[model samples]
Target: MTRNRLWYCGITLAVIAVGLASRRFPAMLPAAAGKYPGDVLWTMMVFFGLAVIWPRLGVMRLTVAALAISYAVEFSQLYQAPWINALRTHPLGHLVLGSTFNWPDLAAYTIGAVLAMLLELALRRFAA
Candidate 1:
């Protein structure tokens, strides 16, 4: 594989490790940190997942798309429709759909997306 592709792969693995730790080992973190790290990194992982599929895509465009999908999922929590709630009943669903609407999540997602974009740009400029 190419150097850039390898870098993306390494970064994706790191994000997954941190995401799992954020959820699985919450006690290791500061109380104030709460779940924000996982929330932000999870959203950033989503962006990286997309980047893995389309690495040639512009960072700005990927950021916009990722932000749109992340916001849509967060806003959908407001509905709590039976189907959506049922979806949340499963572990994977719970992780993805979430249970309730929180305005702070939007901020978290924005931070995640911007950081993902910046990281991608940096990787392209410095690592490439």
Candidate 2:
């Protein structure tokens, strides 16, 4: 594979790994999330911004889809729908949506999407 592809894969894998590891072992992950919703939004925006600025090294549409899925999972957590949460407990679900969920997570995902678009525009300007 090309270096760009390798870098893309590495970034994607790293994000998945860190997200899953945090769920499985909260103690292992930093308590970086603050009570303030803005902080969470900012964090997500930054990460998604990276995806946009480095589109060639990442997959923008996939990243957006993943973020959408993440939001969906968070919303689904509200019902605590046994079947869904049970599915969430699995490695796959935990990695995708997370064990626990909250509506604010959706806002953060939106911030991420917007930031991604903005960053893409900025990168384009820089390139030009």
Candidate 3:
């Protein structure tokens, strides 16, 4: 594959590693590093995933799309229907669909999206 492809692949893999670390090994992290890092990284991964699939998408458009999807997912936590809640009980589903709806997650998603936009801009400029 091309160097640009490799760069994107590497970034995606690094984000996955960070996301997993933020979630799975909380004890190993700093005292206040509970769900915050994971939440931020998770949204960042979403942005990176979009870039991987659609490299030419502009930063503004990508950021808006990422935020909209992340916000929708967060809002989805408000629905505690029996079946959906039951699905959330499973490990994988729990990871994907968080149990509680926190307003702070919106801020975290925004931070992640902004950071991803800046990072993407820098990468594109340097690559050029």
Candidate that would win on lDDT: 1
Alpha-carbon deviation at 102 in model 1, angstroms: 0.2
Query: How high is the CA lDDT of each candidate model?
Result: 0.83, 0.53, 0.83
Candidate 2 per-residue C-alpha lDDT over 1-128 given as tens digits, one digit per residue, 9 for 90 to 100 = 01233443454455445544545566654567533233233334445444545555444563566466556656666667788778788966664446665666667667655654565456457656
- Please give the distance, in angstroms, between residue 105's alpha carbon in candidate 2 and its true position after superposition: 1.6
lDDT of 1 by residue, 40-86 (tens): 88778888877777777777778998899889989989997798899
lDDT score of model 3? Answer: 0.83
How much is the lDDT of residue 51 in candidate 1?
79
Q: Which regions of candidate 2 fall more than 4 Å away from where they truly are? A: 1-32, 35-68
CA-RMSD of model 3: 2.5
lDDT of 3 by residue, 3-36 (tens): 2555776897899798887777888879775688
Instruction: Evaluate residue 86 in candidate 3 and report its C-alpha lDDT on the 0 to 100 scale.
Output: 96
Report how far residue 45 has shifted in candidate 3, in Å: 0.6
Give candidate 1 misplaced runs (Cα > 4 Å). 1-10
Residue 83 CA displacement from its true place in model 2, Å: 3.1
